[model samples]
Target: MRIGLFVACITDSLYPATARATVRVLERLGHTVVYPAAQTCCGQVHYTSGYRREAASLAGRFADVFSGCELVVTPSASCAAMVRTGYPRLAAREPRAADAPRVLELSEFLVDVAGVTDVGAHFPHRVTYHPTCHALRSLDVGDRPLRLLRAVRGLELAELPAADECCGFGTTFAWKNADTSVAIVADKIRHIGATGADVVCALDDACLTQIDGALSRLRGGVRALHLAEILAAGDPAGDR
Candidate 1:
C-alpha cells in the first residue's frame, strides 16, 4: 500500500518522533510511507481561536497540499479530525475553497482501510489509555486504538477511569485559562495514578503534553507514550 504521511505541524515540530514512528510502523508493515513535506497546520488553531477568515485561508492551503495523496494518514488525531470534521465546516462557510481531500487518523486507516486485526508489535508494560477529544468526539475513533493496543504482545491494558473524558487540554483551552486547566488536569492525574499504570498512551500530543505536564508538576510519575511509538515496536522476524 502506498501511504502518504501528513506529519501535522505539532508532530512535525514538537514531537518529531511520533511522526517518525508513524513512518516506521507503516514501513515495517510493508507499505510505502511518503512524507508530504508540503503539509502544515490544518488551520484548527486559527478557527478555534475565532479567526474564521484566516482559518479559511490556511485550510485552503492544506487542501491544496493534501489533494494529491490517495489516502492521507496523520499521527495527530486532532489535526486529522480538523481536516476530516473541521475542514468541511470551514468549507461550508467559504464554499469557494472546498475541493480538499478528506483526512484519516492513523487508527482509522489501520482498522478500516488496512483491515488489520493485530499489528505484530510487542510491549510488556502496564498502560492506561487517554482518548483525545478530537480523536473521540470529532473523529469518532473510539476503542479502535484500544483494540489494537490490547493485542500487543505481553502488554497489560489497564482501564483508565473516565477514559473518554477530556484531559483538560483543548489546544489553547488550557493556555487561556490556566487555573481551570490545572484544576481539570489535577483530576485526570489522580485518576491516572489510581490505576497504577507505568505509562499512559494516547493518539493526541496536545492532551499528552497537558496531562503529562501535570503529572510532572504534581510528581505523579506516570509517563505518557504515543500510540505510534508502541505500534513501531514490531519484532524483526515478523512474529511479534
Candidate 2:
C-alpha cells in the first residue's frame, strides 16, 4: 500500500526521531511511504483552543494536501483524532472541504489495516505503555499498541498503574491549568515509576513530552519513547 505519512507538527519539530522511526517501520513492512510536502497541522491546537475559524481553514488545507492518498497515517494519536473526528465538523459547511483523507493512527493502520501485529522489533528492556487520553478515549485504539509490543522480541511489557489516566498534556490545557496539569502528571509519573520499567511508551508525543518532563525533573530514570521508535528497534538501519 502507498501510505501518505502525515507527520504532525509536534513529531516533525520536537520528535523527529519518531517520524523517522515511523518511516523505517512502515518501509520494513514492505509498504511505500510517501511524505506530502504540503501537509501541515491537523488544526487540533486551534480547534481545541476555540479558534474555529483558523482551525477550519487549516483543516481544509490538510484535506487538500493529502487529497489523493488512499490512506493517511500519523504517529501522533492526538493529531489523527483531530483529523478523523474534528475535520468533518470543522469543514461541514465548505463544499471543497467535504471530503477528508482516511486518516489512521500508526497502530490503527498497522493492526487493523495492515493486519500485522509484529513488525519484527527487538528491545531488550522492561517497558510500560501509558495510553494517552486521545488514544484511549478519543481514538479508542484499545490494546493495539500492547498487542504489537507483546510480539516484540526480547521486550517485556509491564502494565502501567492507572494506564488510562491522562498525562495532563491536553495541548493548551497543560499551559493554561498549570497546577492541575502538574498534579495529574505527577500521579502518572508515580504510576510509571511503580512499574519498574526502563521506558514508558505512548502513541502521542504530547503525552510523552508531559511524562518525560516529570520523569526528568524528578530523575525517575524512566525514558519516554514513542511506539514507532520502540517498534523501529532491531532494524538494519538501527533504532532512531
Candidate 3:
C-alpha cells in the first residue's frame, strides 16, 4: 500500500524524529511511505480554539494534499482524531469533508489496516503507556497500542495507575486553564511515578510533552517516548 504520511504540525516542528521513526517502521514492513510536504496543521488547534473558518480552510488543504493517496497515516493520535472526527464538523460545507474518513492514527493503521501488531521493535526498558484522551475516547484505539507494545522483544509493559485519565494537554485547555491543567497533570505524574516505569509511551506527542515536562520539573527519572520511536528502537538504520 502507498501510505501518505501526514506529519502533523507539532511532529513536523518539535518532534521530527517521531515522524522519521514512523517512516522507518512502515518501510521495514514493506509498505511504501510517502511524505506529503504540502501537508500542514490539521486545523485541530484552530477548530478546538473556535476558529472555525481558519480550521475549515486548513481541513480543505489537508484533504487536497493527500487526495491521491490510498491511505493516510499519522503518528500523532490527536491530529488523526482531528482529521477523522473534527474535520467533518469543521469542513461540513467543503467538498473535502469525505476525506476525513481516510485519515488513521498510527496504531489504528498499523494494527487494523496493516494487520500487524509486532513491528520488530526491541526496547529493554520498563515502559508505561498513557492513552491520550483523543486516542482513547475519540479515536477509540483501545488495546491496539498495547498489543503492539506487548509484541516488542525486550519491552516490559507496566500497567499505569489510572491509565485512562487525561494528561491535561487539551491543546488550548492548558493555556486557558493553567491551574486545572497543572493539577490534573500532577495527578497523572503521581500515577506514572507509582508505575515505576523508566519510560512513558503514547501515540500523541502533545500528551507526552505535558507528561514529560512535569517529569522534568519534578526531577523524576521517567522519560517520555513516542510509540513510533519505541517501535523503531532496534532498527540499525533508523534514527535513535
TM-score of every model versus the real structure: 0.93, 0.98, 0.97
Best candidate per lDDT, number? 2
- Candidate 1 global CA lDDT score: 0.81
Provide the clashing-pair count of each candidate structure. Answer: 0, 0, 0
lDDT (tens digit, per residue) of candidate 3 on 1-240: 899998877788799999999999999999999987787788889988888888888888888888888788899888888877887786566657567538888889889988999999988999999999999999899999999999998999999999999999899999999999999999999999998999999998888888899999988788899999999989997635
- The lDDT, on a scale of 0 to 1, for candidate 3 is 0.89
Worst 10 residues of 3 by lDDT: 92-101
Residue lDDT tens for model 2, 1-240: 999999989888899999999999999999999999988888899999999888888888887888889889999899989987887787665444557788899999999999999999999999999998889988999999999999999999999988888889899999999999999999998898889999999999988999999999988578999999999999978553
Angstrom error at residue 114, model 2: 1.0
Residue-wise C-alpha lDDT for candidate 1, range 1-240, written one tens digit per residue: 888788766677788878878877777778898776777778888889999898888888877776776778888888887776677788877663477765788888888988884777888888888888888888889779988898888889899898777788888888899899888888888889889998898998878889788888767567888898887766553222
For TM-score, the strongest prediction is 2
Query: What is the descending TM-score order?
Result: 2, 3, 1
Q: How far is candidate 2 from the true structure (C-alpha RMSD, Å)?
A: 1.0
For model 2, the stretches where C-alpha displacement exceeds 4 angstroms are: none
Q: Which residue runs does candidate 3 get wrong by more than 4 Å?
A: none
